[model samples]
Target: MMKRLLLVAGAALMSGLVIAQEPVAPPQVDLEQQQALRDAVSGTSRGITNVMRDAYRNPERTLAFFGVTPQQTVIEIWPGGGWYTEILAPLLREDGKLIAAHFDPESEVAFFRRSRTEFEEKMAGAPDVYDKVELTTLNYDPQLPIAEPGSADRVLTFRNVHNWLSAGEDKAALVFEKFYAALKPGGMLGVVEHQARAGTSLEQMIDSGYVTQTKVRELAEAAGFQLVSVSPVNQNVQDSTDHPEGVWTLPPTLRLGDKDRARYLAIGESDRMTLLFVKPE
Candidate 1:
């Protein structure tokens, strides 16, 4: 009887201690440091004001909407020129792992080569920040070898799927399947791409730099992922779906140069789809 009473008292004491523990804080990113990060990636030393205005405004919310925490084993696909890489690497530095994987440029289209040297240099410049980052190459073909199955916790791709569609093998879908196969059960795949209007065909997506949300959902569902959520945080409602040069004619790519600079600037970046999907257990 005495031993039973002692066990009950000990259990209550442990429960009280657990309840008394304070909740831990979310990761802290200082305003100044965030500004510095923007400046570092925006190709300008004085970029914080302009970069921060956009980054902190809408994009961060897109990331938050997807429930990206600092604890996942995240693989970011096609970290071209490391734009998002600059932000994500540091954010995941402390307790999380960030893997920056790019197309094997030796096998990719010619354009990726232009950024190859720059991407390597940018990441090399911050060895400490990327100490936990792993750089892997995606073969763009199904037969190519990659990590073991069920290895990652999340796979994220931003603004690059259209290029895969253009590659003609439906490498995009194959890659999506690979992502599904690479994650543990219940792992996530997060995507942000230029969004096309409903019913835009796949060929048109390759040509226009826009992909319909339906196409993406279909591909993911086919790969055994369950649609979790979609967010409009990155959506741009002003796009009229009638650009002469398509989505590339907008600010970041401005393919036409000075012809529609003012117009594209006013439109800002193209409307994007932010989608989240999870592998079922």
Candidate 2:
């Protein structure tokens, strides 16, 4: 009995020594930074609703899949109401840069004439956070100067591919080509948009403003981006893809009425594709 007790105590001491040698989790943004996010960004801005559930359901993993780190420069394309911006700016504050690329005021199809002031106001109060972020405005002219070549470490576009399909595939293609040119040789372009099925017809997608994974890959690859990997962390498997109004028929933008609310609610958010692409190193 005495020998057994000594062995047990020795084992316990060894376990404690092992644990003490283990590495600690990396340092992170403080409570004030997180509070700023909660105060400045609305639930709607994060696309939160009973329908669009993933933003709230899995935020850290979602941001992680975008290759977001505390050490890389990131550009958010057309940050509508600065939803991701609010979280991203503060999180990247200590060691990285956040560039909010807004549409030029002189251009048509600009969604953020008033968003500028709102974003600036939100950013203004957090000088330490905002100091790490830069606001860049550019016109979407195909013939003009935009982001410099090999400039950004990552370029992220969320839910804007549908607009490209509406504007015409060629128009979207040019923008993507520009996205390719704007990245460093090994930079990433992370895209999260409404996902049509694997076999959805391109013509139908163009009409309804939803694109298939294949279509997205095709466009990105054609523009010199190599398909890297895809994450289904944001996948919504409940959707049946038969909505009368396409993907928008499901949620916050539901164009349909009470007749289909239950049905769409059952479908939850539209299935989304989280694609990662990289230029050749």
Per-model CA lDDT versus the true structure:
0.73, 0.71
| Candidate 1: 10-residue stretch with minimal lDDT | 18-27
| Residue 242 lDDT, candidate 2, scale 0-100 | 69
131 Cα displacement, candidate 1 (Å): 2.6
**What is the per-residue lDDT of model 1 for residues 1-281, given as tens digits with 9 covering 90 to 100?**
99998898899898884343232222234565455334434434223544553632254665555555566677888887776776677667776778777768685467676676577877777687666777877767677534568888788888877877887636777888888987888778888989999988878898898989998888888888888778778888887655888888987778899996898888888888888888876
Model 2 bad stretches (over 4 Å): 1-57, 110-131, 143-146
- Summarize candidate 2's per-residue lDDT along 65-177 as a digit string, tens digits: 66566667788887766667766776667767788876665555545566676677767766765667788764457764346677888888887887777777887787788
The per-residue C-alpha lDDT of model 2 at residue 226 equals 76
Q: Give per-candidate clash totals.
A: 0, 0
TM-score, every prediction: 0.79, 0.74
Query: What TM-score does candidate 1 reach?
Result: 0.79
